[model samples]
Target: MEERYALLLERLTKTEPEFQKAYRDSLDMSWIYHDSALEGSVYTAQELKAAMDPTAPIVTDSSIQPICEEIRRHREALEYIRDFADKKRQPLNIDVVKKIYLILHPEEGDIKTVKYRKDIPQHRLYFHEYAPPDKITYKVRQVLDWVNDPETRRTRSTIRIAARAHYDLLRVFPFASDSGKVARLFMNLLLLRGGYPPAIVHSTERQRYYEALKGSSATMTQIVHESIENNLGSVEKLLEGHESKGYAVKV
Candidate 1:
């Protein structure tokens, strides 16, 4: 599996600039849609295109305005993480995680004042267990420490580390809302830093995802591995199509 992933990355480097942009654009839309869907927020295909595509016609429906804004914020948060992954040399920290949360909810206030859920309401339903309010801070710090530890990075596979980080954060459920999404974003950030593509755990796998969370990070790691493999296959097909069109293959 690792060999296949490495070969796929090598092939991807030979893709044309236009194809690369189109592929990334498509992946970004799918990434946003599936991630939101996993949390039970469904956006229609038309709505997603309208929000994500600058060339698409402007949306004027009053009812859809909030949806569009939410999509925009999520995209901004995605872009922020991508940039951070590319340029930032420092290890992942609490502040960076808080910044991601703040980007997703600017209305919530500044990063300095970012706060976790004081208490989860008993009336509310959640798909997985979360740390109690009193344990949120300590659990979050532990996750950061584990991910940032030099020995952890040196010994563990990137996928395993990323999956464990995601599971740990979701278990902590630091924020009252969007904690799942933030956990995913952080996971992808780690993957990108390790030269792997983002693992877009599709909404189709929602039940499997929840169940994995209920168990251990090992299950989550397998899900991530499969997600990466799926993405690599998708890109491989795209490259094949490009080659069939009489483009000179570099690889």
Candidate 2:
């Protein structure tokens, strides 16, 4: 995994110019997508045009602050993830995963809704609806047990657990807001703390994003591969032509 990260970083740095250019362009596109996602709808062509207006900043201070704050909280969350990853004797059970998500989105501590889904056999599915606190706690626990079980100890199995941590939690809308981002980070963190460099889903690719997540029964390979490809592509582009100006990824 460390080697994988190194290889990815090298590829990205080599393509700095093209990578950075694509990154900038994609960020512009992501702003539009973010705005629409925030509004809970895909953008109309006009709305996308409006989003790209020169005078209109793509991200507002309100949204920006939360992102930065999340990053800060992320630093703290990583500590717990490190501890959990090292505890190989115990598979991460539900209580533990929820605790991580709570650390990431503390504000979601109080949201409640009465809805549920049992589609995923091993998971306490909430089926595209807000889950009540009690129900969420129950399902998360079930997920943890499945992950920790010795039978599911393979890399692919762990990856499947990580993917469920996203699909189930996000689809359930466990948090009042930022559930998607938080969930994405949570699953990736599980991978990262376990030695993976972390898979990143760039906000720019909507078709790929939804399609990657659209199946009635989504799998970890689908989402993980999407993220890996996106991350590799981004890093490769960044390294090709962009001037680092002394900025480098922290070791």
TM, every model: 0.92, 0.54
Per-residue alpha-carbon lDDT of candidate 1 for residues 1-251, written as tens digits (9 for 90 to 100): 55666777677678777777887788888899999999899999888888888998889998888898889899998898889888757768998889899989998888778888998756533567879999998999999999989999899999999999999999888998899899999999998877788899989998999999889888999999999888878877877888789876565
lDDT of 2 by residue, 133-216 (tens): 557656655555665666766645545667776666665555444456556656765776555655555445445555545554
Give the whole-model CA lDDT for all candidates, comma-separated. 0.87, 0.54
| lDDT (Cα, 0-100) at 163 in candidate 2 | 75
Candidate with the greatest lDDT versus the true structure: 1
- What CA root-mean-square deviation does each model show from the true structure? 2.0, 8.5
Off by over 4 Å in 1: 1-14, 123-125, 248-251
